[model samples]
Structure formats: C-alpha cells, structure tokens
Target: MKYFLYWGCSLEASGVNYLRSLKPVCEALGMEFEEIPDWNCCGASVSYAGANDLAIKVLNARNLALAEKKANYDIIAPCSSCYIQMIKVNHEIQENESLRERVNSILAEDGLAYNGSIRVRHIQDVLFNDIGTEQIKRHVTKPLNGLKVAGYVGCQSVRPYGEYDSVHNPVVQDKLLEALDAKPVPFPKKIQCCGSGIFLPEMDLCLGLVRDILDDAVSHGAEIISTVCPMCAMNLEMYQDRINEKYGTDFDIPIVYLTQLMAVAFGMDLKRDAALHHNVIPPENILKAAIGN
Candidate 1:
C-alpha cells in the first residue's frame, strides 16, 4: 500500500519527530510512504476563523493538488488539525463549485487546481482501515496487558465541523489499543475538546476544560491518556502542573500520542521513537509495571 504523507505547518515545526518515527515504522510494515511533493503550509488555524474559510480551502487545495500529481493513494496526515482542515475544506469545495472556482483562481497563481480527486485521512484511520487490526496485532512484540488507557479523541479529529468518526463515541483508538493487547478504559470526556486552537485567547478556559477531562479520565481509572492530536497531547501533558495548582489536585496522568503507544507495543525502542519528548508524566514506568518489566 502507498500513502502521501502530508505534514502541515504545526507538525512540520514542533511535531517533526513524530513524522520521522512514523515513516520508518510504516516502511518496516511494507508500506510505501512518500512525502507530498512541493507541499506548503495548510494555512494552519486560519480555517476556523469564519471569514477565512475560502483562503483556507484554497491553501489546502494547493497541497491536495500536489498530492494528486504524485499518486491516487490517500493523503495521510499525522496532525489532527491538518486532517480536519484538509478533509473539511475538501468536502466544502466539492459541495460548492462556485467556491471551488474561486479557490482555484487563487491556486492558479501556483499553477495548482483541485478537482477533489483525492481523499484526506488521518494516520489513525489508515492504520485501522488499510493496515487492519490483525496486522497491527501481529506487530505487537510486547503486549501492554493490564495497562488501562483512556482514548482521547480531540475535537478536530472527530467532531465540530469535521465528522470523520462518531461524534459522541469513537472506538478507533480503542481498536488500536486492543490490537496492542492493552485495555481501553472508557471515560466520560473521551470526545471532549482539549481547548486546542483557543488556547491563546482563552488560556484559563482551556486549562479548566482540560482539567475536567483529565479528572474524568482519572476517575474512570485511566492511568494514561492516548490521543491522535499533537495539540491535545501538548495541552494535556504540558499544562498538568498548572492544572494541578489551580484545582488543588495532583493529576499526573501520562499523555501519550496514539502512535507513540503503538510504537512501544510494536517493540520499537522508546527513546528512539521520541516518546521521551512528551511533557506529561512519563508512561514508561506505568507501562513497565503493567507488563511486569
């Protein structure tokens, strides 16, 4: 199988390590992973600002055009924001020809045109759909038995304007965990927003929202929180200290990327996989305990 690896600006900057790790893993699994040729920023964070929708659509259309030239394979985005923006805007452009023409006019500058020929998908979807749970299970060199994980499907990846998965309940992460031989703990705030894009103007509000979600996960006996979004991982992992101080509680749940956990389950070296870069509480200790390491 082949895929166009689309890394948007946010991921290209701070989350490059993840892309680096995933590429090798995919290659080892006998998948052809190619970076989109002449890719540019997906105009990150601008799509949600109501008036800038056309501009965002045009920007993503450029990237899609680039991918279309490469192959007919699905464009796989590791970042949730990129996935949401690309998928949602593609849907919009296909539904509105007038809007598509307007966006194509902007793309004409770069000699790019989008006909909505390709589909945008997250790495999670590709892993589950194309790779299959049985294939993922076969890669699990070390089973994470007894490890209780709370799957956090950040808003953009599963909800709001993009309805890629179930809005109220999503089990993609759960299925991935099961393939790793890990227990998926159900929590109330699994689909809740992690205050991703609103962190700047609403810092306190973002922290409060994250705190509530973390508390719910802890209450549900989740030792670690797994997520597909880098922004969600950053907020939940990096802001835990402040959240604890403000709420008079010590919630040190480890925030792990879904890929990171899968890498570990696949028996990839934790240090080389860049799992150590996470700001949240380290999950290695808990994971070791669960596997009797």
Candidate 2:
C-alpha cells in the first residue's frame, strides 16, 4: 500500500541510518512511500513544553491538510515523536469538533482544510499490523539465525496512544524480530524512557537512563538493541562510551533500527542497503550472525 512519509528532521541528520535502511526494506516488502510535499515539523515535545497546544496542533494540521490535498492515504511517520504528534492532532481534532474547526480556520490562511480524511500511522504499526509478520517472513532471504536482539519500543510510540499495541507490554517489534529468526530477549525496560532530547541539557540524567537500558539489555543476553525511534537509537547507541566511562562499566552494544535488521535478513547489502557502517556502534555480531562470514 502507498502512504505519505512524514520524515522528521532527525531522519535527514542523526537518524539517516533509519532512512537508509527503510528504503530497501519497504521496496522488498512492496510498500510504497510518497513524501508529503511541503510538510512542516510535527511540533514534537518542544511545543508541549512551551504550553502552546494550538501551535503544535496547527503545525501538524498544515501537514495533514497538505496530505489530504494530495490524496486520501495514511501518513506514515518513521520518527516516534513525529508519529505521536501527528496522530495526537488527528485523534484530538476528530474527537473535538470545535478544535478541528479552529485548526481548519487557521489552515484557511493557506487555502487548506482538514476533514480528517486520513490516518497517521507509525512505521512500526504499518509493518506489524498492515504487513503481518507472515508477510514479512516471505521477504527474509537470510534469516538472522537466532541473533539475540532487544526490541526497544521507547515512550513516544506507546505512550498517550496505545491503539496499535499494548503500552505496558509491547510485542510488535519483538514479533517482527522473531519473524526474522532473531531471538527477541526478555527485556523489562523496553518501554522505559530513553531521556530523548533531554540528553543535551541533562547529560548526566539522560546518561543514567541510557545506562540502565543498556545494562538491562546486556543482562538479558542481548547482543544488539533494535529500535524504531531515531532518538532512542541515538541515545542508546551514541552514548555507550560515555555511559561506560561515567558508570565505571563496560557496555558495548549495537543499536540498530528494526528496518535495518529486516534489510539484512532480506539479503540486502549490509554496507550499502542496511547502512550498518553508519551506526555508531558497529553491529558486527549481527552481520556475522546473519551472513555467517
């Protein structure tokens, strides 16, 4: 099925690896992604902190209005923060007619109005619900051969909206890993917060949280941590050395996107398609497990 991709800022910069692996995986799965034209930011958490609800809603409304103007297809957001923000606007506007009218009135400035014609879906939901595990299994050419991967769902995707999967106990990512022949380890803190953007101001606080996540994954015998959110991957992968230094521990775990693992299992080039070379923590163990070289 075709969907409009709402690529948040990170995909072009920090999360480029996710963008890289997403392309080949989608192609192999027969999923078409059309980027929304002239889409703006989804306002993410920064807007929430500023306490300007309408501003954030209007930001997402502009994108939704644009997508509706193009065609009536689901908007797929790969970023967890973007997905939550967009879906929040979609859900709230649908439930609150007055708010919808207000948002549309603001959109009138740009000759756009949203009748709530489409749905906002995360890439994780689309891969799990729309494209079932069995369907994904068909595309796997080189199975992971029991690679131990911890699926980090993070907070943005599950919190404030658990429509796709259980917020408390998420299984979508783990299920996808199992379909790829990778062993999804029993990780308790999968849903715990990764301290997201707070890592910048509160490095110590964020580092503590990241350290916990990494420790939990390692304790559970996970060789790699797979996630859907770029922020989560960034926090988990990019801070290993710092975490080790601060905590007086040795934590060396690879953080890879779920799409990357899918690309690898589908026999896509590790360096070219999966973009393993771009990851902060090299997933050499995963490469060895999947390719056996």
Candidate 3:
C-alpha cells in the first residue's frame, strides 16, 4: 500500500485538483505515498516529440534514482502522462545496458545513479489490481445510487503497456465505479485520445476529439464522466464551452477524476476530499446523487 509518489508538472499546476482529491481518497483506502524528493518532470509525450531519447531517459532516471535512494518502494504516478514516460524509461533501462549506462552517466553529474530496481506504475493500475474492488466497496459510505457515469480511460494509461488491463478498452475504472454503486454507461470513446499533448498546437483537432468523447458519454446516458488523467479531465471539462461555440452544439458535461468519485462515495467532504469546487463544469448533479443534498 506504499509507493514513491511522483507529482509531475500538471499535478502541481492545472491538475492541482486531481492531487487534492487524491490525498483523502488514498488516506481513506489506507494507501501511503512517500513523494520522491526533488523529482523532475517525466518529460511527457510532448517532450519526447521535441527532446532526444537521452534527455527524456535522464529526466526519469534521476527520479528513479531518487526513489531508490529514498526506499525500495515502487514508484506511482497518478498522471497517465507521467506514468507512461517514467515506465517507458524504467522498461528501457532494465532491458538496455547501453541506455542505462548513458542515463546513469548523465546522472553521475548530480551524484545519482539509477540501477532500474524500481517498478513504475500508474495509480489506476495500483487501485484496480492491488487495492481491489472488495476493499473499495467496504469504504463506500454513500453508494452512488445508480448514478450514470462514463469511465473515461484516456489513451496514455493503458496503451503500449497493457500490463493489468486491455490497451484499447480498459474496464478497471468502470469496474471500480460499479463497486461504488454507480452505473457505468457504455462509453465507446472511453479510451479515445483527448489530444492532450498537442492541444495548444492543434486546437481544432483536440477539440474535435474532446467533443466526440463528451458526445459519446452524453449520448450513452452518462450524467458525468470520471477520468484517471488530469490532462483528459481538463481537456474534456474546461473546453465544453469552447466546443459548444465552435461546433454549434450545447454540451455541458461534468468531468471528474476517478478518485474524486471514490471520495464522493466514501462520504468525504466535497470541497476538501473531492475538490468538486475546482471542476469547471460543477458536478452538482453528482453531489445530489451521491449525498442526496
């Protein structure tokens, strides 16, 4: 139940609410997270597009080295982008001696070295595989009462590394919601790309992707969409108005983190534990469904 937490750039900035909601949810579940000291960005997919392999690997390797020095716990990143970046580096270093040597040599400047002993995992993977639904059910004080929800499992979480779940279609979030008495609606675009990495550069394309996901969720009778990644949540929730303006459609969908939904079911404080106030599209309906207030 313990892991080295890596709070990437988003969690500290635009994704702050995700980190806020995560704290109490993990606390309620008896999960302990020791943050890796002085951890840098995992050099997201966007970074990979611009930077060289060595630069990205070095960034993640420094984090792995810090975690190794701190303790023997596995590293966990709540952000899907961070999870993929770090895991890719961890996977690569473990298999390629040349890559490891190069990364370690760069780290040597900072008096750090990564032996690739730690495992990098997404928080969703840990919650679904390690924590289990039974344990989660036991913590649910306020069942969702069949609240229709779409489990948006964005692209980065499962793709290219389907260790615990399917790459194209993941059900961990849906299964977890079911345990909380929430009815998971059939969302075809659950694993759809939100175009997060290229959102700024390709605004139109990203909006189309976001609009499609939201459209699918709304069409399937989802009252709200639960997400695992902050980037996805932000893209979906924050851009609804823009999407409506651009597409000549009226769409107001509430986007929430899966952990936030868990917090609601656990009967935790909406503002404190769930950080519902932070959501762009206020999930007032979700609040009413879960707590009947």
Task: State in Å the error of residue 133, model 1.
Answer: 0.7
Q: Considering every candidate listed, which one attains the maximal lDDT?
A: 2
- Predicted candidate 1 versus true structure: per-residue lDDT over 1-293, tens digit per residue: 88888877666555554665676567657779788897877766644566466667777888888888778888888888888778878888889899889888898897878887898888878888888889988888878985889988877787655344576778888988898888898887888887887775788889899998999999998988888777887788888889888989898888877777777777787778735454347787877676666
Q: What TM-score does each of the candidates earn?
A: 0.92, 0.97, 0.97
Candidate 2 collision pairs = none
Error of 1 at 134 (Å): 0.8
What's the true lDDT of residue 180 in model 1? 85
Tell me the lDDT of model 2 at 89. 89
| lDDT computed for candidate 2 | 0.89
Cα lDDT of candidate 3 equals 0.87
- Alpha-carbon RMSD, each predicted model: 2.1, 1.1, 1.1
lDDT per residue for candidate 2 within 36-74, as digits (tens), equals: 898888877766788687888899899998999999989
Q: What are the lDDT figures for the candidates, one per model?
A: 0.79, 0.89, 0.87
- Cα lDDT of model 3 by residue, 1-293, tens digit: 78888878998888888999888898778889898998888888888678887888888889999999889998889999999988888999999999889888889998999898999888888888888999999999988989999999988889888977899778888899998999999878898899977887899888999989999999999888999898898788888889999999899878888888888899988888888888888996666756677
- Pitting candidate 1 against candidate 3, the one with the higher lDDT is 3
